[model samples]
Target: MAETTAETTDVASQYSAQVASDLEQNLKEQERLSAEIEALQAQLAALQHNHSVLTNIQQALGTSAAAAVSAAESVTKVPAPRKKTATKAAASRRTKSQKPATATAKRAGKKTAKASQTQSAAQSAAPKLVELVRAHLSAQSEPRSAAEIAAALEQEQPERGIKTTVVRSTLEALVAKNQAQRTKQGSSVFYTSTDTAEPAADGDQSEQPSA
Candidate 1:
């Protein structure tokens, strides 16, 4: 009886030791799983904080970019008002310092009136010269120089200062008007009237060619 009791006590002690070892292994496994869960949570928190930081940086950069764009547009747009103001000021100064536009117009009108009077006198003078040229041409059979015409007219009417230059210019004008034609010999121009009623070629007068 005593030997059986001792063997039963030894088996009981061995069974208790096996159960304690199994319990210790289970505690170690639980510790490893807990550590893995804690590491995963820490990594997740770090990822979330990085995402928030990136979002904030992007928002700040967008705000600054918008401000920069607005500033650049203002730099170009601001000059238009200043230019308009300067133009208005320049025009006002010119208005104060310059003469009235009508005064300048009046001076121009005076010059135009004097020019009109001169032109009218010249038109009137042309007819008198034409009459004198025609009368001389009608009386002659041979062509005569303008100087000869002027000299004859001066003898005929000596009271006037009938210039040779005036008669020459008049003869030239008659030639331009086709009322007379000119023939040239050496250095002289001679005038011949183109009319049909002059003294006949074989009548009392004879044509004298240039000597």
Candidate 2:
């Protein structure tokens, strides 16, 4: 009876020890899972906060860009006060009558030379005016009157300040150069153009043939 009692006691003690060990292992596993869940929650909160901050920053940048674009559009659409501008075209050069050497023949001086250079602008015809007159005369198939040539030059060079005198002088110079012929009847003058003809009869003195 004593021996049976001792055996029974030993078996019960061994079973109790095994159960306690299993319970300890289960508690340790539960603790590990709880810590892992807490870390995950913390990470999720941080991610949500970061996403919100990034979204706000993007919205602010978009608003600023829209404002800048609106400002640029307004600037382009609005007209500024206009500035008045004056033309200096007439002052750029002297008139045709301002260039010649009439006073130098009467009285020669430094002042006279300076005056001559500025005033005697008429003595030498403008190269541009001469060329314009020649081109017009050459293009026409028939003799054009002085008035006709002046009117044509007016259309051709509205910029050079064309006048009747400039055209008349240019035609006369052309006659002198033998590039053209001049015909005068009563008070009317007309120009007849020619091409590569036997060189002028005495080129230097090739003035308009006396009527």
Candidate 3:
């Protein structure tokens, strides 16, 4: 009887120990799962807050873009200012104001044309400087200095305003044309006319009748 009672006590203690160990393991698992749930809840709360902020920014941007488009449309839809109508009195006044300037310009142009014509006629009437220079050189029997020629011409025509520089330039032009000869003697320059004509060609000489 005592032996049967000791076996029953040992089996009861073993069952109780196993039940206590199972309870401890269940508490640890529950703690770990609770911690993971808290971390996941915190991450989910952060993501929701970020999503709310992004939604607000998107709404603000859309409102701003819509407002800008409305403002642009309003500006483009505004009417332009109307031009002033030309009344008969205003037209007459403008014509009167412009007529004097137009008439003045026309008179000025006419006066300029007349003056130019008068100057041209006077120049045409006068002998050319080159002809005068050649005539003076040809009239001289010997080579004449530019100063003497200029002085004689000035004396002959006091109103002509003959300049020595102009005479010298004319002499040089004649020399270039081979119609005058230039000679230098001891720093003094003189010019003489070339009255000799070019020699006739051989064909011309052959065509000429013999005396």
Indicate the worst ten consecutive residues by lDDT in candidate 1. Answer: 72-81
- Go through the candidates in order and give each one's C-alpha lDDT: 0.68, 0.63, 0.71
Better of 1 and 2 by lDDT: 1
- Which lDDT tens digits does candidate 3 get at residues 93-186? 5556555555655565566557657755875898876888899888777889878998989997787667676677678778999998888998
Q: lDDT rank, highest first?
A: 3, 1, 2
Per-residue CA lDDT of candidate 1, range 166-204, in tens?
676677667789888888897677988877334454443
After superposition, the stretches of candidate 1 with alpha carbons farther than 4 Å from their true spots are 1-127, 196-211
Give the Cα error of residue 104 in candidate 1, in Å. Answer: 46
In candidate 3 the C-alpha lDDT for residue 52 amounts to 78
Residue 101 shift from truth in candidate 1, angstroms: 50
Q: How many backbone clashes does candidate 2 have?
A: 8
> Candidate 1's C-alpha lDDT?
0.68
Q: Which residue segments of model 2 deviate by more than 4 Å?
A: 1-127, 196-211
Expressed as tens digits, the lDDT of each residue in 16-103 for candidate 2 is 9999999978975875565456545645775786577557655655655565556445444544435432123222222211222223
* Candidate number with greatest lDDT: 3
TM-scores for every candidate against the unseen true structure: 0.34, 0.32, 0.38
